[model samples]
Structures are given as C-alpha cells and as structure tokens.
Target: MSYIPPHKRQTKGSPLLNPTPAPLFNMRSDFNKFRTWNIGYTDHTILKWFSVGLDDELRLSSLVSFQPLSPESFETKSGIQPLSLVSTHQGCNEGIKNELIETPWLLIAANVKKDLLLSFQHMKREMEEAVMAQVKPSVVARFGKILFYGSSSIGKDSLKLNSLTETTLRKMKGSFHTDVPPSYMDYVEDRVAENLGQEYVQGKELYYVKLSDKLRTKSIVSCKCTVAKDHNKIQLYKIELNRVRHMVADMSILGKSSDLRLFVNTKKIKMALSDEEINEIKDLIASAILDSEVPSGIRWPLDKRHSSGGRYVVNAIGHTTAKSL
Candidate 1:
C-alpha cells in the first residue's frame, strides 16, 4: 500500500484505515527478545544489542523501584500485599541448546575475604587516628609545670596544612560557615578584673573552663594552651562588685584574723573544706575584700595591682643557717 503515489489513493477515510505505526522500542520477554520496531534514537537507554565473538561478560545492574501508583489506596490496612524478587531460573531445562550459566563473579568475589578484612582494618585505624587527634590527650609529655603551648584558629582562607608547632596547635575551630566572629577576646575582661571588690565570695570568682564543642568532626587538634583566650590581649578591665554566696562565705572579718581559708566554686556542699586543706593566697583574699564604700573593708596596697601572679613563699624567722638581708 505504501508503494502507491500519495495523491492518487483515496483521501477520505484512508488515514483512519492505515495500520497502527510500530513503536520505536518494543521490548519483549524481559530483554529476552529486544528489538527496535521503528526509527528513533535514544541517548543512553538501550534499544537493541547483540554479541557474536565478544569475550567481555555483560553485567546489567538496573535499579527497579516500584513506587505506589496511588499513595492513598496502596497504604491502606486491608490493601497490604507482599512484594518480593525471586528468580526461579526454571525455564532453562527445556532443551533449547542455550545452556544457562550461574554468575561466576559472585563465587570469585567470595574468595577475597582476607584482603577485604585487611582493607577494612586499615580504614578503621585511619578513622580512629583522625578522631583522636581532635580530643585532648589526658597525658601529654610536655605539658608540665609551666604552659609552653598555645592554640590558634586558622580558617580555610589560607588552606594551610594544620599542624602542631613547637609552641602552638594551628587548628581548633569547627567546620560550619558563620557570619558572626568565631570568638571575641580583645575586649573580654581578665579574670582578676571580673572578681574584684567581691567580699569573700568564692563562686563568682573567674576561672577557666574547658571548651567542649571543639572536639568534633572536621576538628584538627585540641587546644594546647592553658586558656582559649590570652589575658594580655584584653582591652577592657571592668571591675565588678559581687555579693556573698552564703553567710558562711561572708568571712572577711574571719579571713583577716586567720591565715587559712578555702575558696570553693560550688554554691552549697555538705563536705565543707577543713582548715588543714585550706590553702589561702594573701594577695587574692585582700583584693576580693577591698572596698572604698565600707569602712571595715581592707584597703588595697598602694603599689600592688588587684591581681597578679603569686607564689607560696616562707621566710625563716629563727633558723641558725638563715642569713638576713
């Protein structure tokens, strides 16, 4: 019928009488018989393929996901149906001359158990090392009496390799992007300035606390310093007056009389510190109680600062070997 000229044939119902056009790709029998029925070109999907003398084995791995056609109906309690994938491998004994062969790669891959285990162990060791590098070591070889180590945060702007130098740990921050500053220290008051004029109040005294969030994924090393912020860089030194935690802590008069007292951080505890365990620093106790408003308060020394490094010193009063200046 297609050999006839176009205009010469009947034009009236001829279009309807024409046979149905064949499809571009009419796959049959689950790729057992794959054929292109009509002229068309697809980008990556296979239309038809065959092998004559090729040696390479063909392994077709396709994801077959059966999504619910109707979400509202398929998920009903009464509509629950079992779904599974099972290959009977049955129709092979029909004497078709084409022998069925089991997948050879599956058995071959099972022999690689020893090498696979070794590779897994190697991966585990590397991962453990990376994670432990971010944690603070409980026992460091060189963190002795004096702190010689420092911590600095270097961001991705430089992409420098993180490392531990003679005096510093180069990276201790996190991996998230942020607009706010990482940390503020230039204007933060020092420990001494924050606890001044507090009359024997122990809990309000400033102390360094551990930074917990820096031990996480994408972290490099724990801070190697005694402090996260340097006190010498402080620009503001605001003096704040604090109140006593308890009547027991309001011991300015008692402290002035005795040379021993304990400065505990807890607000309340049943196990009170004894006089034997109390190790009082004269410079610290004087600074905490010094006040201009109260007449009974201790007046601070003229030349001495409110806070500074101190030592536990003792002088010989009557020892025969002692020499006087």
Candidate 2:
C-alpha cells in the first residue's frame, strides 16, 4: 500500500474534502437536506466541526453495532432536527432572539459572565496602575441582570405576533407596530434590586421598610406632586422605615440615624402606572421583610410627616427589621 501523507490522511475523514459528503448532510436526503433552506453557516467547516454532516453516519453505525431489527431504528438513527445557522447581522440578531426565548437563563448567565469578565479586566489593569475606582459588586450584578433581561425581551413581541391567528395575524402584519413594553422584565429587575438591597442592608440598621408598590420600582420621583393645590416640584426618596413609631420615637430621642439612600429620576415621569405596577412593587418590598410583614402598630399617617427642619419625608414602616421603643 502506498504511504498517504499525514495531511491527506487526516483530510480523508473531513466531510468538506470528502467527495461523498456524510449522510446527514447529503443533498439527496429529504430529512436533513438544507439546499433550499438557506440556513447560512459562517464557515462550511462548521458542518464538519459540529458533526452536522457526520451525525447520521455516526448514529447509524452505532445503531448497526447494536443490530436492532425494529423499523423504528431506521427512523431514529437516520435524522436529526436541523438548526438554523446564521451569518448576516439581521440573521444573527434573530438567532440571538430565538436563543434568548428558548433559554433566558443562558442570557442572564452570559450577561453576568460578560460583566464579571469586564470587571476582572478592569481590576487587572487597576492593580498594575493603581489609580482606578474598583468596580462595585452591586454595579456588576445590576449590569449582568440588565443585559440578560434585555437580550431575552427583544423578541417576545415577534413571538406574540407569530402566535396570533391567521385573521389577527393578517391585521397585525400590516398594522403599525409599537415596541414591546418593558414590564415583562419587571420580575428579573425586581429580583436583582431585591438582592442588591439585601446586600446593602447587611450589618446596617434597616429602619422604616417602605411597604408600597411605588417605592420598590423607583427610588426617587422628580415629578410635580399636587401639594397644596399647586404642582410643586417634588423629589421623593424611597426610605424603608420598618417601624415608623419606634423609629420616629427613637429618632426623636436620639438624632437622625444613617440609612441607605437613592435618587429619583427626574427625566422619566410616571405618566400612568397600572394597578399591577403599584401592587408589584408593594409585594416585592413586603416579601423582603425579615420576620413579620405586617405594618400595624406604626404611627398613624407615618409616610406624610414634616421633620423639624420643615423638610418632607415619607417613612415606609414594616415589621421585618425593628427594635421597639
């Protein structure tokens, strides 16, 4: 036998160089055929690399080794569901969208990984130079979750449209389309915020747990509140005061204590909040309570109170974390 060169020998099994392509990707096969499908693979080598071409041959050989006589053997060992590979920008975006819908956790994990990788990169540079602000864990965590949520949500509207009936589909197909609302991602967003808040509250006296739906989604509201019959520019801060009476009475005795703070977004106004929006935020904060969730035994109208300096404050009272007076 003539000695075959190593490179030529290796190329023998390669589906690309092989004159007879592997059975899985054979042009004649009806099941795995993609000639008409136009499922674009960036590299033709992708077929050989991922076993898309050789899958059927390998599967058949494995089946024959077992020597099953059943008709099901032919059906099961011969075919595989073809994946839609993409190369173009639009196609890649669609692929990402499809992937996110199928596996939202993957999106979340990817985002988290990306953020962590970025932070570590930043840290590595900082250690060498020693002048940069170290990335905060909370910031990294927030970004990861946001990326995950955003990637996952970009295609939900298309999915909804695809699910519509023919008549409705026809109507929607021609109609002007608005973008998907951001509310679908509120759960993930709330969970991230909840985790960050918990971390922020560690070893700190968490006074006044604000038990309201409006308080959770927003930390600050830079809208005009109708105060005393005038639309006054109000900047409301979300302060979770667990025990308003106890905390108020405690603060009355011993001056104001330290609390975690956040700023309101003056740019986006809460133009119209649904009943669900209010309730969702309320439930999130209530669930964050340490022990009892009941806000009873707190002072009357605890939220609307003026401090000694004539500054407005809203005390969110909850029984989660508290020390009674």
* Cα RMSD to the true fold for all candidates: 36.8, 25.1
Per residue, candidate 2 scores C-alpha lDDT tens digits across 198-285 of 3222222232333222333323322111112222211222322111000000000001111111111101224455556444443333
- Residue 112 of model 1: what lDDT? 27
- Residue 227 displacement in candidate 2 (angstroms): 32
Q: Give me the candidate number with maximum TM-score.
A: 2
lDDT of each: 0.21, 0.24
- Please report how far candidate 1 places residue 144 from its true position, in Å: 57
Q: What are the per-model numbers of colliding residue pairs? A: 0, 13
- In model 1, the Cα lDDT at residue 170 comes to 18
Give the number of the best model, judged by lDDT. Answer: 2
- Cα-lDDT of candidate 2: 0.24
Quote the positional error of residue 89 for candidate 1 in Å.
Answer: 4.1
lDDT, candidate 1, 253-306, per-residue tens: 100111111111111111332343223222333333223364322233454322
Clashes of 1: 0
TM-score of each: 0.14, 0.20
